[model samples]
Target: LVSEEELARVEARLRSINQFAPVMHCTHSSVSVDQVLNIHGFDLQRALKASPELLNTSAAPTKHDARVSSVSLDQSAPRHLRTVQKGELDLDLLQEWIGELLNNSGEDIFRMKGVLAVAHAGKRFVYHAVHMTFNGCFDEPWDDEARESKLVFIGK
Candidate 1:
């Protein structure tokens, strides 16, 4: 096991590399699932308290590719959470864009999560990626919810 002083030094080095990125330390036996989620910017209690209508709903489509909004937990840093919304998206184009993004700026992007409304697809495409690695699958049917694509990126 590394000493606390050594850990602090390592954390400091990482922070110097990316000041806006989250730095956390956890042992396999000590870290809870909620702690993990919080590090990734998912706050369960905050989400539970949020109104259902405020969740996953997108605004009216504009001429832009997507409406964007950003937030930063630490006032010292620039915006770290970026939300992008669109009414519909082309799956092939989206994949190409993501690939390009990872190839070009993966180091700056910490994580990305999205629920996409792909053209001609009946079910929603749900994906979450950390850095350059990605995982996605067709989730539940769109049902009554608006067929809107919402993507959130957490990055430096």
Candidate 2:
């Protein structure tokens, strides 16, 4: 769902990636094909050395007036990893947040997703959205996996 130019535009907006958790960098699309399939020996060390900024990131600041943009929320939720402190997020509050996001957008929000750990419950919620359409449901109970919330929204 992202192109090279779009990725570049995003990369241009980063400051110190203080957390080292930017979604795109964490979710890089496999480029091994450009190596293995093309018979070019894949060299991880060479690639890392060549892209110095990937190791020390600081780039032109983002201009939100531009077409494409992003949002990151470090909202605390019960049992979630975005923060260590315990917090509560009831279903009503969850819906309120989602409603505001969809309603506030000028159809500029193309997508979103959330993995939530609810207050007073052993289960979690998984939600997805595209424009005004969204779907959500209670998922399996908490497991050994660390609960985390992740959302990605892209728009023009």
- Global CA lDDT of candidate 2, please? 0.67
Report the C-alpha lDDT of model 2 over 1-156, residue by residue, as the tens digit. 679898776776663333222333435555544433555444656656755555554765545767777765555444454543435477798789889878888398877777777777677888888888889988898788556555566676
Predicted candidate 1 versus true structure: per-residue lDDT over 12-96, tens digit per residue: 9987754555666777657667756755665655554653433444844336323333332222233354334335788899899
lDDT of model 1, residue 78: 31
TM-score of each model, paired residue for residue: 0.49, 0.47
How does residue 91 of candidate 2 score in lDDT? 76
Q: Which stretches of candidate 1 lie over 4 Å from their true place?
A: 1-86
TM-score, cand. 1 vs. native: 0.49
Q: Which candidate is the best by TM-score?
A: 1
